[model samples]
Target: MQRVTKERCLEIISRFEPTKEGREKGHLGIDGFTAYLLSEECDIFDEEHKEVCQDMTQSFTHYFISTSHNTYLLEDQLKGPSSVDGYISALKKGCRCLELDCWDGPNDEPIIYHGHTLTSKISFQAVIEAINEHAFSKSEYVLYITNQNLIFLLLNIEE
Candidate 1:
């Protein structure tokens, strides 16, 4: 780090100095002024002189969340492959929210893919399992899952 010499401090304060008429009679000289400016009164590193925030509480609206759309698509929206890897990747990268486009699949199972397009489909169950396994690998914050679908499929499974 560069050292702050008396000459440098004088040079810096000279620009802000008042005109001859504005200066008070027997006012402080350059050396005295520089010394005063560099004293404890002007030292930002003085811990006891710093301002502290007494109220640490913050409203939920004050926070910004990180989210992603079409989180199951690994590449381009149209031709990408829908896989649980996408969800895992997003979660590991600190995405607090993920979007899954769901649709009906074979045997009445739900699958995720880009609807009305050529994107490959992935098992919704696999995506959910992946999320459960890796959701907290990178961060301890809550993760929200939002599905985009015309119909919600209901199923019963014993853990």
Candidate 2:
């Protein structure tokens, strides 16, 4: 049992050949084993994201990456402030959903943001564009409920 990096996870997935003799029966991305090692060897998953006194369990398949700091990262790159790069990075990281805040804007523009004070500005359409454009390797899931029309747009948008 060992920790699983994304590359290592991919490697393990690659070895799951159904044609193999004894290896023909189940999901083998090594999640439970990896979690056991982390819990026993190092106190890694010992925090709130772990479990206690029970058979080991591998968690959900999806990875949740936060987009809060994305704005700052993009801002850092610009040496000022920007939301563009962060929005792009979140999509690249395969974010299943984004928690955003929006306001009723002039000319029916659904302005997306996190707070009353605008640190960076992005419209609902911009977010959709980024997600749709990155659809090739993306897992395509809910964009969450922040803006209803945007969510509706996502639902109706065909592949």
Question: How many clashes would you count in candidate 2?
Answer: 0
lDDT per residue as tens, model 1, 2-26: 6878666555455334545324343
The window of 10 residues in a row where model 2 has the poorest summed lDDT is 64-73
Give one digit per residue, the lDDT tens place, for model 2 in 1-159.
467676665444445423343233434435544543454444544565433343324432344433333332344333344454565676566554554556676699976654545456577677667656763345444443234346332432556
Considering every candidate listed, which one attains the maximal TM-score?
1
Model 2 global lDDT (CA atoms, 0 to 1): 0.49
Clashing pairs in 2: none
- lDDT, residue 39, candidate 1: 67
- RMSD of every candidate to native, in Å, equals 15.6, 13.6
